[model samples]
Target: MSDPTTDPAFLRDPYPAYAALRSRCPVQQVPTGSGGHSSYLVTGFEEARDALADPRLSKNTAAFFAGKESGRRIHPAVAHTMLATDPPQHTRLRRLVTGSFTTRAVDELRPFIARTTDALLDRWPAGGPVDLVAELAVPLPVIVICELLGVPEPDRAEVRRWSGELFASGAPAVIDAASHSLADYMTGLIADKRSRPGNALLDRLIAARDGDDRLSEEELVSLGVLLLVAGHETTTNFLGNAVLSLLLHPAELQRLRQHPDEIPSALDELLRYDSPVSSATFRFTTEAVTLGGTHIPAGKPVLVAIGAANRDPARWPAPDTLDLDRSPAGHLSFGHGIHRCVGAPLAKAEADIALRKLLTRFPDLRLAVSTEHLVWRRTRLVRGLTALPVLASRT
Candidate 1:
C-alpha cells in the first residue's frame, strides 16, 4: 500500500486519505518514509489532543536517536531546540522567548505589517495574473521575521532559500544540508549581535538571562534557526492556504468581505478547515502508552495528524465544509499542550493584516487558472500551494 503521507494525489488533497485512516482506527502504525521506520499515526481528534499532552510521549529527538544507526543525520543545532526537548528544558527555553511573541508585542508590529502588506499589494500588476504565493504569501512573513531577527537585507534571500530546503519532502540530504547551513548562518548572526548590540529581538535574546543562567551558544543558534524557520514558514503556507480556501468558498469569502469585522474571528474556521501544518513534529514514546485504545511500544515515534484531527467528523459536524460561522474552539492546528507553536500570535497577526489588505485592495481577486493546475508542495509536514496564481482587479 502506498503511504498516504507522501503520495502525490494525497498531498494535493489529504482530507480524504485522513478520513479513511481515521474511520478505521485513529491510531495505527504506518511507514513514515524515514529510515524505514513506521510511526503511530494518530488521527482521532480526542486521541491526538491527548497524545500531544501525554508526558510519556517525548519530543527529545536527539535523545531518541542517540544510539540508532540511521543514514540520515540531523544537525545538533537543529535537533536540540525547544521543539525537541522535554519538561524543565522545554519550560526554560519557552519562558525565555515567550515575552517576545506576546499579544502586546505582536500588536506593536501591526503598523509595520500593514505597511508591508500595502507595499506588496501596490506592486500587483493591474488586471494581470499573479502568483499570490510568490508575490504576497511568501514574502510577507519572511520580511516580518527578518525584521524581528535583525537579519540584513542582503542575506534575507539566502535565509529564505535555506528555510525552503529544510522542508523539502523526500530529500534528506537537502534537509540536512539546509539545517547545517541555517545553523551556521544563525551562529554567525548571533556572534555579530553580541559584538554590536541592536534593538532587534535577537539582540534581546542574546542578552536574555534567567538569574544565573543564560541560553548557551548552541541553544542560542538553535533557537535562532528555529525562530527564523518556524517564524515564517507556517504563516507563509497559512496565508496561501487561507487565501485558497476563501477563493474556493466564495460565499464565505463574500461574507467576510461584506462584514470585514468577521475576518479575525473567521481565521479559526479557516485554520481548522485546511490546516497549514499537516502533522506536528516527530514525537517518540519514552515509555509504553495507550492512545485511542491502541498499545504503542516504548521508543516508537508518533505522528499527531493535525490535519486529520481538525477535520474529524466526530469533532466537528460537516468537517469538510468551510463554514465561517462555525465555532472552531478546539482545533489543533497550532497544536495542544506545552509544545503548541510559540509564534502563533505573530502568524495570526500577519494573516489578519494580509487578508484584510489583499481582499480590500482587489475585491475581484480570483484564481487565474483551473483548480486542477494548482500545485501543492510535496511535503507532508506542511500543506501549502507551490503557487497560487490569481487575477487581480485593475483598480
Candidate 2:
C-alpha cells in the first residue's frame, strides 16, 4: 500500500485520504518515510487541537535526535530554534520577539502593504494574462518581510532563494545547504546591525532586554533565520491559495468585490477552506498517551494534519463548502497553544489588503486556464499552487 502522506494524489488534495483515515480512527500510527520509524497521525478536529497543546508531546528536535542516527545534517542554529524548543527556552525566545508582531505593529504596515499591492498590480498589462503567484503573491510578502528584517534591497532576492530551498522537503542536501547559507547570512547580518544599528525589527531584537536577560548570539542568529524564512513563506503560499480559492468560487469573489468591508472576516473562512500549511511541524510523544483512543508510545513522532482538521465534518457543517460568513473562529491554520504562529496578525493583514486591492483594482480578474491545469507543490509541510495564471483588465 502506498503511503497516503507522501503519495502524489495526496499532495494534490489530502482531504479525501484524511477523511478515509478519520473514519477508521483519528489517531493512527503511520510510517515516517524515514528509517522504519512510525508516527501517530492526528486527523480529527478535536484530537488535533488537543494534541497541539498536549504537554506530553515534545517539540525539542535537537534532544530527540541527540543520539539517534539521522541521515540528514541540520545546522545547530537551525535545529535549536524556538520552533524546536520546549518552554522556559521557548517562552524566553517568544517573549523577546512577541512585541514586534503585535496587532498594532502589523496595523502600522497597512499603508505600506497597500502601496506594495498597488505597485505590483500596476505592472500588469491591460487585459493580459499574468501568473499571480509569481507577479504578486510571491513578491508582496517577500518584500514586506525583507524590509521588516532590515535586509538591504540588493540582497532580498538571494535571501528568498535560500528560504525557498529550505522548504524543499525530502531533498536533504538542498535543505542542509540552504540552512547553512541562511544561518551564516543571518549571523553576519546580526553583526552588521550591532555595529551600525538602525530602526528595523532586527535592530530592536538585537537591543531587546528583559530584566538583564538577553538573547544569546546563537539564539539571535537562529531567530533571524526563522523569522525571515517563515515570515514570508507561509503568507506567500497563503496569498496564492486564497486567491485561487476565490477565483474558483466566483460568487464569493464577486461578493467580496461588492462589499470590500467583509474582506477581513472572510479571510478566516478562506484560510480554513484550504489551509496553506497542510501539517503542523513535528511533535514527539514524551510519554505513552492515548489520543482519540489510539495508544501512542513514548518517543514516537506525531503529525497533526491541519488541513484535515480544518475540514472535519464535525467541526463545521458542510465543511467542504466555502461559506464566507461561517464563524471560523477556532480553525487551526495558525495553530493553537503557546507555539501558535506569532505572525498570524501580519499574515491576516497582508491577505486582507492584497485580496481587497486585487479585486477592486481588477474587477474582471479571473483564472487564465482550466482548473485541471493548475499544479500543487509537492511538499508535506505546505500546500500551495506552483503557479496561478489569471486574466485581469489593468485599469
Q: What are the Cα lDDT values of the candidates?
A: 0.90, 0.88
What is the per-residue lDDT of model 2 for residues 1-395, given as tens digits with 9 covering 90 to 100? Answer: 25553566777677888889888888898876655767889999999999999989999988888887877777888877889999988998998778878999999998999999899999987887899988888889999988898999888889988888877766889989988999999988888888999999898888863225478778888898889988998998999989988888989999999999999999999899999999999899999989999998999999999999999999899998999988999999999999999999999999999988898889999999998788887678888888999999955
* lDDT, residue 66, model 2: 85
Please state the error at residue 128 of candidate 1 in Å: 1.9
lDDT of 1: 0.90
Write one digit per residue (lDDT tens) for candidate 1, span 81-131. 889999899998899888889999999999999999999888989986999
Evaluate residue 298 in candidate 1 and report its C-alpha lDDT on the 0 to 100 scale.
95
In Å, residue 330's CA in model 2 sits off its true spot by: 0.3
